[model samples]
Target: MQIRLAGGRIAAEVHGSGEPLLLFHSLLADRSSFDRITGQLAESFQVIVPDLPGFGASEAVTGGLEPIADRMAEAVRDLKGSHRPIVLGNGFGAFVALQMVIRHPGLVSRLVLADCGACFSEQGREAFRTMAAVSSAKGLSALSETAMRRLFAPDFQAAHPELMQERLAAFLRTDPAVFRAACEALAGLDLRPDLTKVDVPVLVLVGEQDEATPPAMSRELAAGLPDARLMILPGCAHVPQLQAPEHFLEATLTFLTNDDTGRDSERVQAVA
Candidate 1:
């Protein structure tokens, strides 16, 4: 489950069989956030989920963005062999996925950008800056509860205390320094200029209740892509896969299968 990269070891888990699909977790999350959806996805595709550098069991990165992108692309390449694979990322993970498409176009056959937005703008930069500052001053524990609440609708959280606690625990498991680094990376990211360079088919999924990135931002990202589709999931928050597993799975499977309509009969009904 661990591969030695140039500067560190990348902890990645592989499951199922068939076409390869790579998963990237959100800013404060690791591969385990997708645990509820992975089993179902693995039934049809080979799901490769990695705990990004500085998060979970993955080693920290000594270099910056360029090296980070190269390392992630390399990880994907190692997982998929010669054939380009579908790359999917949620939240911060989506940002990295977009970078992969732009920085290593030939390595990705398709993209699934969930709960992320256009980072090529002042507002996007500001969000990252805010996260960086907060992480540096307050640490991951201070932001854990708020982060969880922000990822879901008001009623959703009230109904899912156990789920929120589980996720918050994961987010808090990382070292404070590592969390701060992630925030700084987010603040420094702005890939608007490179969006046009991405030629692969893309699917952008947004949560209707997502205030962090908002739905409009996701729309803008979809508009910038060459061949892309946008789907807004109702009654969901920042982490739709965790907030509404069935809808998230439908949107994801539809995108991966090349269904332009964003509709799939098969749905993951329950969370793991």
Candidate 2:
């Protein structure tokens, strides 16, 4: 489904029933990135997955993360009324989710941040700048290999050649300008100081082998947030949901359904 928000059209996929649960995909990725775990999540909550503006079928919108968050909040209100739904965001989307909570407090009931951190390290920022420059100069094809390396662990990439090619094709199809824009947006992101402001329960999940954000960043995020717990998925990389769907679902569902004070008690079993 597509909804007119602000000045642009936002494309989204809505499924199942019950309380609303919004899923936000990563940079260079569309809503289909969450296809692996959508069915399981939908069984218990209404799943609303949308393509970030400039990424998929969603029309591009102006401004950075703040304006995007505002538009997303508006879309949520329009779709579910006064309902404050649970939000799950990965990679760039996680940054947007954090922006949403900070910009519009009480907009999200609970938060699940996956493969994201409070802020990028200096080296990470440099990498993003390089990505933007490369994409702008050489186009999306030039970014395919680097993007895959940053997204999946070496073992997974080696084992799943078919899936790797599939993702590469998708990445190649993305508009280089949009990819560069996203890289620039990420280069400017810094949410460390604002972490203390987040009062809602949060679940921070990261792949143990994640190279993009890294586990150390996730640790800082968990420590900074007022009420947050960290869970590391073994042998997984940037996109745990894609690389380890069962473990991802178990960790996320357990956290979302748990009534406990969002502590470490609800552990997501590490896959062997």
Candidate 3:
């Protein structure tokens, strides 16, 4: 259903009870990306997953990533109310969540930053530029395969053909304008200096085989934060939660519930 935010209405799914857990999906993917795990998550917390600013039923907004982040932050304020929620962001959504935390420090209690970094390498920025240009000129259908490759590893895609088809459908549903704007914003984004503002604990999780935001990027993000832990899911790619739901849950469940005391143990696996 549509949830009203300070800026606009957004499509969202809410489940279970306990503390709130907000999920932000990747640019190429929609909220449905979390379907495989939301049920189990709902068993422990009130999991709220939205289509982001422009990906699904939510209306699109202009003026770059700041507005996108602002809108999402508004969603946080509206849903969270008196409770400081736990936020989990994947890929582009991670960037949005980071900006949200930077702009509003006390809005959330903790963050599960997955497959995102403070800034991209030049080569990474160039990749987004090339994608935006191609998708703009030739359209998303032309970039479908490339987009899927960025989401899942090639072997994984080959192994899960039906799931790949479903994901492709989700990607094609994205608005061209929003896609280009997001790509451009991500290419120019730099959130390093603001990382210090996030006083809440963070779990910087990444897929070992992820090329989109590489493990190195997660390392940089973990190093920049005030209080954080880094965890790497073995043999997974960008959307590990979809590809390896077990590992994703194992790595994040404790942190999401705020029961993570084993900072040095491999309770949810280690980063090295």
Candidate 4:
């Protein structure tokens, strides 16, 4: 489905038949990033997965995170009506989700952020800038290796060569200009101070072996948010949903259902 927003048309995949749950993809991925978990999530909630503008089938529009969030928030408001949906964002999408909360309070019922932090370290920011430069000058192919390293853990890549190839193919299809723009935008992001404004129940999930955002980044994000908890998936990398889908789903379901009494669960566990 394509929804026309103020900025441009947003390409989305809608499934299931309950309350809305928006799934936002990472920088290197499209809506398909959540394909593994969508069925399970859709069983209990309506899953709305959209390609952020400039990726997938969405119209490519150049702007920073604020504009992107505004457009996405408008589209969500139109689709879900008065129903406040739970939002789940991964990597770059997580950054946009935080912006949505900050820019439009009460727009979301709950928040789930995966593999993203409040702000990147100086070194990380520099890395993003380098990615942008490389993509702009030589295209996505030039940065494929770097992207893979940031996206998946070494062990997972070594074990799942076919999966890695699949993702690489998808990465090659991304618009280099748009990819560079996103990287530049991310390099300037710092959402630490605004995290306090998020009042909804928030769940922060990160892979223990995640290299791009790291576990420390998630710890900072959880600590900064007013009502938030952090869960670390063992033996996983930047994309835990892909690296450890079962564990990811269990922790997510538990958090969304509010079955656990404790506000924080540092580790992912199977839900009985």
- What are the lDDT figures for the candidates, one per model? 0.76, 0.83, 0.87, 0.84
Encode model 1's per-residue lDDT on 231-259: one tens digit a residue. 88988888888878888998788667754
lDDT of 4 by residue, 157-232 (tens): 9999998998888888888888888888889999998988886888888888888999899989988887788888
Better of 2 and 4 by lDDT: 4
1-272 in candidate 2: lDDT tens per residue? 44444344677888888888999888856678899999999899989898777767777666777777777877666664456889999998898898889878877889999989888999999999999998878877887889999889777999999989877777777777777777887888898989888869999999999899998898888888888888899999888899989999989998888898455534444544
| Candidate topping lDDT | 3
User: RMSDs, each prediction?
Assistant: 4.4, 2.2, 2.3, 2.3
Instruction: Judging by TM-score against the true structure, name the best candidate.
Output: 3
Q: Which stretches of candidate 1 lie over 4 Å from their true place?
A: 1-8, 80-82, 120-124, 259-272
Which candidate model has the greater TM-score, 3 or 4? 3
Ten residues in sequence with the least summed lDDT for candidate 1:
263-272
* Candidate 4 TM-score, true structure as reference: 0.93
- Alpha carbon deviation, residue 45, candidate 4 (Å): 0.4
| Alpha-carbon lDDT of model 4 | 0.84
Task: Indicate the TM-score of model 3.
Answer: 0.94
Candidate 3, residues 52-109, lDDT tens digits: the string is 8887778888999888888888888887456798899999999999999998889998
Q: What TM-score do all the candidates reach, one by one?
A: 0.88, 0.93, 0.94, 0.93
Model 2 whole-model lDDT (C-alpha atoms) = 0.83
